[model samples]
Target: MATPPALVFSDLDGTLLDHHSYGHAPAAPALAALRARGIPLILASSKTAAEIAVLHAELGLGTAPAIVENGAGLWQPGEGSSQDASDYRRIRAALQALPAALRRPFTGFGDLGEKGIAIATGLPPEAARAAARRQHSEPGLWTGDDAGLLAFAAALAPQGITARRGGRFLTLSLGGTKAQMMAQVARRYGAPLTVALGDAPNDAEMIEAADLGVIVRNDHGTPLPPLDGEASGRVLRTALPGPAGWNAAILDFLKQLDRRGGARTDG
Candidate 1:
């Protein structure tokens, strides 16, 4: 069978985009390189659909489907979502139903209005509003004294929800993970040699699920914890930090792929 183009699932913040500035300029060369080769770069991020929608346009990714709200929803090209998406209201309701003590510590976006979100996220007021447009998960700074967060997690567990800790906050989603969504995306492309890039614990599953795993160095000046299969040759970690590291690693991976003549192999 003719080999399909390699599918790339990339996390935005701290990976493809700068952790602080939220710019992907350093990765421009790599992005262009992939574009030239017709590689599909699917942005899978914790950002909301509104946020990713603007970014998709900025990146010139006309109508390509993007995984939004940390895989709790999918955004296809065109007017709006082509598929059924998750309901943030349900997540909020569940949180509201939790015990006051268990819920008080989790300062989620639901509690932070646009202004507070803007201040906390370092985003502009409008951008913060878009971020608050949650469809699946709720993200916020986990400010809890003692074991409150642990109790919160336990409370959420039985509700079919989980908290994914990122650089700044813990995101709560209902049985949704980037890895699961990426695998669903793979089915669309005949499962071409999957490569995933990420920089934090939230990305562990997606990183592990990839045929080629890329651990992009974060701004913290450290790499993430060991993924389940990093000992093998399929995983790579960048030497630099931020998008500079992201660019270099992607270029290297592409060159390696080119060495195989653009053919997807089972190896």
Candidate 2:
């Protein structure tokens, strides 16, 4: 692939979409600008491939891929529904193998079913079904105490499974992060100047890894702490929240690139 001027990686919830409404209408302008410049926009989210594919097509991202399952997997464009549930099965099997005391507290999506997921996430029945279609990670509510949680993770570690707490759920994965997947995707695009936008602790690594990082305002979640890049102005925080903030940050950065004569035109 020829080197593009830039590539953008963005978190969906609380970043590119309204935290409550889950709409990106406010970001239409910036989305258009990116399209006009032929810049690839990769949606990075904990959403499953089934879930992300709908939005990927809705956003008209063409062949750009997405970082899905909280970076546990990638969703390439044009791919049909994934038949490979091997990783998901492995993770579930690992959980079942744990002691009942360690296992009973974690109520995973497999245990929740579609109706339970819909109630848990406020997604509609169909959307919850999509969310439940896990391929590489399992997210669940951890009812165990902190010590038990620690023990749970420790036991799984030997099996190559890792646990991360994000929002209301404890997510288990075989081990991959948004930053790692971001680098892999950037390399596919010829490593163009990268910009990453996100609004949570899970996004910190990817934000720090990019050429420019944007911390989109998120009133619904805990604010990200000041990052090292902020001191050098390589990272910026948006004044507004959600997609509106995403729009302003992206447009401003594009302007800066334009002024520096660095914004590459589409060939």
Candidate 3:
């Protein structure tokens, strides 16, 4: 398939940057190449707007808004249209259904006065301790491990929130899938051929929805779960990890799109 001059929608953290609690370097040359070709890189991540803002500055991106809190809201550069009002309403409704004890310790973007929002799962002290000890490694990143996080999620069963782990944090949402966020943004941009890159389950929806889905290899050099093997002849897998992986994925897909007349470069 040919790649077009397209909006390359990517996730932050593990997919594009190491963010080893210290923010690693990106493939600056490759990224510069993309920019030189007039491709706009859009960040879609679980990071809060505040966090994403810092990253945007670091990445040298102007003000491209990101999907914060796992697609709960969309942020655009110089635009604050409040696209996810319904998603937030649903999130609040879901939170209201939970037992008071289960909801007390949580906070969100609204609570922080538009800085960013999040809903906490007030885990039991001991369980929280275990979660902190085993599941969570990066402070201010995760609540705990898969098992521990899942347990915490279970406590919110009544409220219907799911805990998904991303590069720096665990997020709760009222079933806000990344695909939904991607589609919404794509629509605004006339739904151009999308190239989505991510490295975890939370990104599954967006990856599948993209014209091309590229899953970055994990820390162990393992690829994220492949698309349904039988029907996904279009899916691509990358051997590269971190920034290198992102560069590879974008360059390769753009090549494919160019070859097939699916995309074009400005220069």
Q: For residues 78-197, what per-residue lDDT tens digits would candidate 2 score against the true structure?
A: 877687889899999999999998898899999999999988878888899999999889988888888998999999999888887654467888758989999999988885599999
Candidate 3 differs from the real structure by a C-alpha RMSD in angstroms, to one decimal, of 8.1
lDDT at 58, model 1: 92
Quote the positional error of residue 249 for candidate 2 in Å.
Answer: 1.1
Model 1: per-residue Cα lDDT over 138-180, one tens digit each: 8988878547877888888887888887766789987568998
Index of the highest-lDDT prediction: 2
TM-score for each candidate, following the candidate numbering: 0.91, 0.91, 0.68
Ranking by lDDT: 2, 1, 3
**lDDT value for model 2:** 0.89
List, in order, the clash count of every candidate structure.
0, 0, 23
Which 10 residues in a row give candidate 2 its minimum summed lDDT? Answer: 162-171
The global C-alpha lDDT for each of the candidates, from Candidate 1 onward, is 0.81, 0.89, 0.60
- Kindly report which residue stretches of model 1 are placed more than 4 angstroms away from their true locations once superposed: 1-3, 79-86, 145-147, 221-223, 263-267
Candidate 3, which segments miss by more than 4 Å at Cα?
Answer: 1-4, 21-24, 79-160, 167-169, 220-223, 229-231, 261-267
